[model samples]
Target: MGHDTVETPNLSFGRGRTPGRSTPYAQYARLDELHSLQHPRSKEPAELSFIVTTQVMELLFDLIRHEWTIARQALREDDLPTALAALRRGTHAQDVLVESWDLLGTMTPQEFNSFRSLFGEASGFQSAAFLHLEFLLGNKNAALLTMYDGMPDTQDGLVEALRSPGLYDEALALLARRGLELSPAHSEQRYRPSEEAAQAWRRVYTEPEFAALQPLGEALLDVAERVTRWRQRHLSAVKRTMGGKPGSGGSSGLTWLRKSAEQDVFPELWTIRNEL
Candidate 1:
């Protein structure tokens, strides 16, 4: 008979490489799984680099979304330090995503064209988690939501994330907690620029006492800015590979991505920056 047993990660926490350096079974178990994830369609050697880079970026994006979710909850609860920690984690994740792009940028146009046909209908457009991340950031679109309905479980996760408040929503809530007036409607799933929210953030910027929240605001902006950079670079890559062509996923390629890049996730977060 098999009994229920929970496996714990055997990690050696120590000061230096001398004590905790050699982790055999535990390290091997995780790394082996990571190694098996890449299955590129093409025999071309460079395909491995492209596939691995995209996968790594996706993993980083998942981590960032998770951290932001936690941070948003913490801010909603008026827990500053916990919110700050999560935001810091998110910023670190953003850095990793940007660096992953740099590695992918190494793939020449010829190399991408080699594997492009093999990808068929598989595009970054089909990344369910990425769509959910976008929806979580209050960039919800009915068309995008419908794309996931065929995949019930994926659609469910996205629906939940969409209904939840974003990092900006929580920040506005925090301002309200700090005696600043913000409309209740600002917390809704659809993003709309609130003149009142902007005024509140402007006050927070002017006051030294609200400096911690200011840093939190700037950290959120850093995340938004980096993500925008990623989208732009992705568009650039698409143009470089297949100039003015339709995407493999049935979109207008660079044109679609250009429109997407123009849409800001947390609109008021950026608008407030101008006022501040």
Candidate 2:
């Protein structure tokens, strides 16, 4: 008996694709291009792990930034439910970002040293995606923009992010719209804790009238706490792998990270707890 062959249907799974020729998963995900991105500069087997993990982190940073941007935009429109949903998603991304340190947390000093030289001035400090996340979180530092002077497109993007109203800024604006008074925050400056902002948040926690905003305040705090955790985990991972040595990107390594980890992400949100 002869068996008849069945022809596969030509289905379009992604844009501009010959459907029957390739696996839809690979084509849609562009897995070939993503897998091709890891070009380790050294023969050390552990180098690939480091490079892959770093790339994974950069992708997560971009994801979290995207969520925060959505939240900021939603808050600008006074859509509390939408803003809270986006912030909750951002915190979940931040949670994964913190846990990603597990991939590199066990790197021995010798293993890192084996490929460290190959990195040569390249460092996570230079990650534009992570910097954008920082700016969106209101950690603006104009001096850091100088680092990307050679990369004009990246610098331009960072300049735009730096000048845009941050996630916290929109939250405050929403509060002001609801009859709470708050001083305008400087878009291009690093976030500073203000008594006025703290008092506003305190009202959210204590006053029955502003009780509707309590969830929004809590969601913002959740995001801030996760960001602090991510920074602390980064500091811990670097300390264990490289000790007090200077960073590959020309910063004071552990010292700089320690200072950064110590700083709260949303200062007023944290400070308000003392009074509440």
Candidate 3:
């Protein structure tokens, strides 16, 4: 019992052979390239957090956009379960996106000032990914496309998104297919909250026949509410860091964000809740 036995090392592959360049996980993730992208402009210590957080938020924005696009396509195909799943995934992405501000929120006005000038004309308001997300959520402002005039591909895609059917459009179409009297024109036009649409949602909630749509409506509402909350958090962050200053991208900053936040994401969903 006192005698010690030799211990053998556990190696899945050949001894001393580490997972090399052929590793599928590294190849698929391209983590090396991803990690290489963060080059902050200033020597300020806090700039690193700002840079990485913005990059993370941009990546999350892409994920949210992808999921919402999947949800819109699913809705178009009359697949409620698949659409709900995608919307739920998108909400998770939004949750992370909203929390991302906490990292940058730690930066004070003086800290941000160190590298703020390095930003020049760049600002979160100019984020094309976020603009695309807003378009998909049924808030299309064609004027914003002007901001990307130098980027033809991005501008064209945004124009197409502006004309395309949004998530709310597909939701209304689903309701129409189920015998609700919603106009197809709502799919292309800037959406306005209508009394008739509210009544339809009321039916979806109160009537047993339309019960299947209840969860879809609630999921859509959940997304809209989360988006609004994210906007509120964004406004708060900007106010805390910059206070009344104009955005580096030539926008009105907090005033503009405040007005923008007041604009509802899915208007009919909230309007319907009043009737319910």
All candidates: TM-score: 0.83, 0.92, 0.90
Q: Could you give candidate 1's per-residue lDDT for residues 133-241 as a string of tens digits?
A: 7766777665677877789998888777777776677777788878887764433346777788777777778887766677777777777887787788887767776
lDDT by residue for model 2 over 152-238, one digit each (tens)? 999999999999999998999899888787766656998888889888888888889999999998998899888889889999999
13-67, model 3: which lDDT tens digit per residue? 3334344532455468875577668899989999999999999999999999999
TM-score of 3: 0.90
Give the number of the best model, judged by TM-score: 2
lDDT of each model, Cα atoms only?
0.75, 0.89, 0.86
The pairs that clash in candidate 3 are: none
lDDT of 1: 0.75
Q: How would you order the candidates by TM-score, starting with the best?
A: 2, 3, 1
lDDT winner = 2
Candidate 3 ranges beyond 4 A from true positions: 1-23, 187-189
